[model samples]
Target: MITTKLYNRYQTVIPSEIRKKISVDPDSIVEWTINEKGKVELEFRKRLTEKDIIGLIKQELPYNSVEIKKRSGRGLDWE
Candidate 1:
């Protein structure tokens, strides 16, 4: 298990290997919560925005252009 000490009020470096295993980035906003036993933990990151989703899709499927599925009952409305 990795042991980390909290120092200075606003500066802490989560170990690089841990960050890589968790796929966390520098600008991520972390959420901390305490369990019933008073042990604090960081929750999973937030949901991705539409742009984030698109970016991930492109990263995974670089050769493919995504096709949008329009809502049902939409009748030829192109503006």
Candidate 2:
């Protein structure tokens, strides 16, 4: 098992082996979780950008500004 010492501020450098295996960079996000058995887990994810979520919302109908204004007048938000 690879081991590293935690500094006074509780910060520890990730070993090169682990870093290479996970392919994490400075911009990567690290998620920490504890299971029922109290085992800690680490997951790495890429940071999200506007381009990544541009089309996340599915559109079934065509866009209509008039319909949007009417819906807004009726207090409907994104129906």
Candidate 3:
């Protein structure tokens, strides 16, 4: 296992090897959690914005447009 020393203000630098493996960058978000066994788990999350989602949607949709499905009936139909 890799070990690191806790510096002032309880901050420690994540090792380069770990960072490379996880593809972490300056803007990456890190999540920390403690389980019932009192073991700490770290999760990496990539930050995304509405603009990013719109771009992804454009790529996924046909002709770069959003198609809404419509029903014939006016009200909700329950069988």
Candidate 4:
């Protein structure tokens, strides 16, 4: 297991190997959780952007203008 020293400020750098594996970089949100079994888990949270949403629609959603209109309720209108 990889180990790191906690500094005076209670801060520790994540190991480079682990960071690379998780695709974490500067400005990434880090999440910490402690389970009932006393196991601690660290995770990197990825925030979705507008570009990501567009890409998801392009890739996964089929063109359904009627369903889109019903679900959106004038949201797509340019008023």
Candidate 5:
């Protein structure tokens, strides 16, 4: 079992090996919650902002003429 000590500020390092295995980076946001068995659980999640949406639009994607026609109010059979 991995062991760690609480520092004077009550902060503890999650151990480099464990962090590497879990793919967690420094200063990454983590959520700690308790499960039904009172076991601690950690989850990594990133919040999306307006900038993220713009970046998604800038990213490469498949073309969709059907969607374009529908969006333009054109009569296009989409069967």
Candidate 6:
């Protein structure tokens, strides 16, 4: 098992081995939880970006920004 020392501010750096194994990065979100058996769990998740949701919405046709503006009555010059 990997071990790390808690510093004065009650903070500990996750070990490199564990970080690499979990693919943790600077932008990763850490979730801490305690199971019913009192075992601490750490979940690492990457922060979602626009690129991640690009294809989340199913579309029958390619997105057209101009068409969207026209439908919204904002005109092609919409800022």
Ten contiguous residues with the weakest lDDT in model 1: 64-73
lDDT of each: 0.63, 0.80, 0.70, 0.73, 0.70, 0.78
lDDT of candidate 4 over 1-79, digit per residue (tens):
9999999999999899999998887868888999999999877978754434543544453555555555566556432
Clashes of each: 0, 0, 0, 0, 0, 0
Tens digits of per-residue lDDT for model 5, 4-76 = 9999999998888888887876657889999999999989766544334443454366646456545446655
Write candidate 3's Cα lDDT for 1-79 as tens digits. Answer: 9999999899998999999998998878999999999999999988874345555443443542232212212343424
Q: Write down the TM-score of every candidate.
A: 0.52, 0.62, 0.62, 0.57, 0.55, 0.65
Per lDDT, the best of the predicted structures is 2
Clashing pairs in 3: none
Among all candidates shown, the one with the greatest TM-score: 6
| Candidate 1 Cα outliers beyond 4 Å, as residue runs | 46-50, 53-79
Q: Which ten residues in a row have the lowest lDDT in candidate 2?
A: 48-57
Off by over 4 Å in 5: 46-53, 57-79
What is the C-alpha lDDT profile of model 1 across 1-48, one tens digit per residue? Answer: 886787879667788888888888866778999999999988657555
Candidate 6 per-residue lDDT over residues 1-79, each given as its tens digit: 7789999999999889888888899999999999999999988889886457566789897686556546555433534
Residue-wise C-alpha lDDT for candidate 2, range 5-44, written one tens digit per residue = 9999999888989899989888888899999999999999
Candidate 1 global CA lDDT score:
0.63
Q: Write down the worst ten-residue block by lDDT for model 6.
A: 70-79
Clashing pairs in 5: none
Q: What range of 10 consecutive residues in model 5 has the weakest lDDT sum?
A: 50-59
RMSD from true fold, candidate 4 = 7.9
Stretches > 4 Å off in candidate 6: 59-79
Give the RMSD in angstroms, all C-alphas superposed, for model 5. 11.3
Deviation in angstroms for 2 in model 5? 0.5
